[model samples]
Target: MNPPNDPRTAADDDAALRALYGRAQAQISAGTTARLHRARHAATTGSTASPARRSWAWPAAAGFAALFALAIGMQSLAPPAPPTATPAPVLAEADGAAALDDGVADALATYEESPDFYLWLAANESTLLAME
Candidate 1:
C-alpha cells in the first residue's frame, strides 16, 4: 500500500531546498568562481586577443611619428620669396654734366662784378690751368 501522506516529507524537502540555497549563496560570495576557468581557457587559445591585430605595429608607429614631425617642420619652415627686380637707373651722364655747367654760369655772374677781380683772376687762371 502507498505510505501514509506524512508531513515529514514536506519538512525534508524544505531542508534540501535550504541547503541548495546556502551553497549557491556561498558560491556567489566567493566572487565569480565559475567564469574564471573559461576566461583562462580562452586566453590559452588566443581567443581573447583581437584577430586583426597588425604585426608591423612598431614600424607603423615610427612611420606615423616621422610623418607627424615632417608635417610640423613643413608648416614651420616656409621660405620667404625673393625681392622683385628693380627699374633701371633713370639719371644719365648728360644730366649730371648739365648741372655742373649751370653752376659755372652762376659763378661767371659774380666774376663780372669787378674789373680788378677779373685781372687777378686772369693772372691766376694759368696757375690753376697748370694744376688742373
Candidate 2:
C-alpha cells in the first residue's frame, strides 16, 4: 500500500485503473458483451417508434383537455343547489332553562336531606387536593 503522501501521478493512477478495467472486461462472457452493446446502441438511437405510432398521442391529449374544460364549463353554468331546510333542534331555549332549574332544585333537595354526605365529599376533596 502507498503511504498517505504517495508520490504517484494522476496519469499513473488512471493507467492502473484502465488496466484493471480491461482485465474485468475480458472476464465478461461474449453474450453479456453483446447485450451490453445492443443496450448502448438503443439508448444512443433514442426512441425507435415511427411517426405514425407517435401521432395518436396529440389527439388523445387534446381530447382529455377538452373533456376537462367541458366539465368546468358545465359546473359554472349549472344553478346553485337550493339551501336545505333543516328542522330546528327539538330542545327550545325555554325548555332547556326549565330542565336546568329542575335539576338544580333536585340537587338542593338532596343536599338538604344528606348534609353528612356533602360533608364527607368536601373532606375527601380537601385530601385529594393535598395529594395533587
Off by over 4 Å in 2: 1-23, 39-64, 86-132
Give the local distance difference test score of model 1. Answer: 0.81
Q: What is residue 18's positional error in candidate 2, in angstroms?
A: 6.7
lDDT of 1 by residue, 3-34 (tens): 45777877887899999998887867334665
Instruction: Note the clash tally of each candidate.
Output: 0, 0
**Per-residue lDDT for 52 in model 1?**
63
TM-score for candidate 1: 0.24
Evaluated at residue 101, the lDDT of candidate 2 is 100
The C-alpha RMSD of each candidate to the native structure, in angstroms, is 30.1, 8.5
User: Candidate 2 local accuracy as lDDT?
Assistant: 0.89
The best candidate by TM-score is 2
Runs in model 1 with CA error above 4 Å? 1-39, 44-54, 81-132
- Per residue, candidate 2 scores C-alpha lDDT tens digits across 13-65 of 88999999999999999999998887788779884535588889999999999
